[model samples]
Target: MNERTEYWWVHHDSRIQPAEVGFVGGIPVHFRFLGTAGQVRAESAELIERLPAPPTPVFRPPPAAAASPAVKPQISGSWLWFIGILLLIFVAQCSGPIFDALK
Candidate 1:
């Protein structure tokens, strides 16, 4: 029987083959090969040690005048006058019954 050896490109910490990109619940990763090993090896300590540390993320401030102040809505007095006239007409229509009830 012929025994064939296989090699995998793996993450250093997990010691498993790199998963397909955008896999649900998978770790977000950028892969860089440190070295190679025999198929049977569980871990590669030398490669893990030699691999460069991941770069630190830098924050950028937003533009100085990216946004403008929001304009507030205004009500015109004409609407208020219309509403008042409608209320006056409603009260005038009901005034006869109201006066009769008061007697």
Candidate 2:
């Protein structure tokens, strides 16, 4: 069997708030949600890890933001209002006919 030493900071102190860019004792570090390993990346100054932690997962900085902007389908407000008014007209027209037929 093989065993490897791993380092992780499971929880951060309440006093030290994470930030996009910050320094710890003069060492610079950028903080962001990696969404991987689910751990914050920092210098391994402290070897101790908090209890009830997940498996020894390595933490790495998130990838740089892509230059290409994400494009999403968008609907104009005018089109939405048009559709809603049309729906209301259709319902109003249908309801009168429906009630008349039922009576």
Candidate 3:
């Protein structure tokens, strides 16, 4: 995935089947499908100001140095607070089981 460029393509190709593509910045490009041998085509552009950017294929950051650290979820609290939460969930979950067992 090139952050500096964007690309689009049709997933499947059939003989003599035309492919339709849309771009954010420029006029949509379409290729008259010649055949299975010439079905796929692609185009790209440098990230430019005011250019409608195409949707990225994947939602992931490019690997690089100086990457921001992921935020860690904090689980710090008083022991009593932790016990209370666990007890509440335990009761809620076991209430069904306890009632079923009783019957």
Note the Cα lDDT for every prediction shown: 0.46, 0.48, 0.47
Least accurate 10 contiguous residues by lDDT in model 2 = 2-11
Candidate 3 positional error at 90, Å = 0.7
Which portions of model 1 miss their true places by more than 4 Å?
Answer: 1-75
lDDT of 2 by residue, 44-73 (tens): 233233224334438876776896689876
User: Each candidate's TM vs. the true structure?
Assistant: 0.26, 0.27, 0.24
Query: Which residue runs of candidate 3 sit more than 4 Å off their true CA positions?
Result: 1-77
Candidate 2 Cα misplacement greater than 4 A, ranges: 1-58, 76-81
Error of 2 at 52 (Å): 34
Sort every candidate by lDDT, greatest first.
2, 3, 1
lDDT of candidate 3 at residue 75, scale 0 to 100: 65
